[model samples]
Target: MDLYRSGDHYVLHADLPGVDPGSVEVSVEGGILTVKAQRSERTEHDVQWLASERFAGGYMRQLSLGDGIDSEHIAATYQNGVLTVTLPVVEKAKPRRIEITPGASEERKIIEPADAPEQANKT
Candidate 1:
């Protein structure tokens, strides 16, 4: 499995050759993302196999997502035996530049209480 950040989303790629796309399942719960796939075994009684090295069973993987990720908008796609999952970052979590405006005046004003004697003397 390979994971990387792309723009405002995180992309995950997993290799699942010889596996049916219909048998793949993805779910997220409690900030944990789980991926499951099943590869059926070949049942051939009339033919003899010379060698069998490919995996034929269940495949599962899990990942813990951070608070910045928007789990509700996650997407997954399978193509050419490769599965790609996209995790988008929340709008509030994204970084942005803040604009600063110039003030109208640089003068400072101080308000004094009516009963204050020291403030009256300064004025």
Candidate 2:
């Protein structure tokens, strides 16, 4: 599985060849993200098995997601033997640019607090 951050959300990709799309499951609980999948093997008794090397069983993976993740909006999709999961970060977790207004750095520019007038009267 490969995971990477794209913009405000994180994308996860896992390969599950020959696995049924309906068998894939994804859930998040208590800040933990879990993914489960299953692939069934051929159980025909009449066929003679020559060689069977492919994996066939349940697949489960759990990841400890931090508090920043928005678990309520988590989404997943399976297509062409690939499972894709998207985890979006909360609004507070997203990066915000702090605007640096033209402060008192220049003599022509003056920065005053909202309570500046009240403080002056008290002085």
Best by lDDT: 1
Q: Write the per-residue lDDT of candidate 1 for residues 1-123, one digit (tens) a residue.
A: 999999999999999998999999999999999999999998888888999888999999999997989999999999999999999999988999999977888777676776588767889
Q: In candidate 1, list every pair of residues with a backbone clash.
A: none
lDDT of 2 by residue, 90-117 (tens): 9999999998888666668464898788
* lDDT value for model 2: 0.91
Question: Clashing residue pairs in candidate 2, if any?
Answer: none
lDDT of each: 0.94, 0.91
TM-score of decoy 1: 0.76
Count: clashes, candidate 1:
0
Query: Per-prediction TM-score, please?
Result: 0.76, 0.76
Model 2 earns a TM-score of 0.76
**Backbone Cα, N, C clashes tallied per candidate:** 0, 0
- Model 1 scores a C-alpha lDDT of 0.94
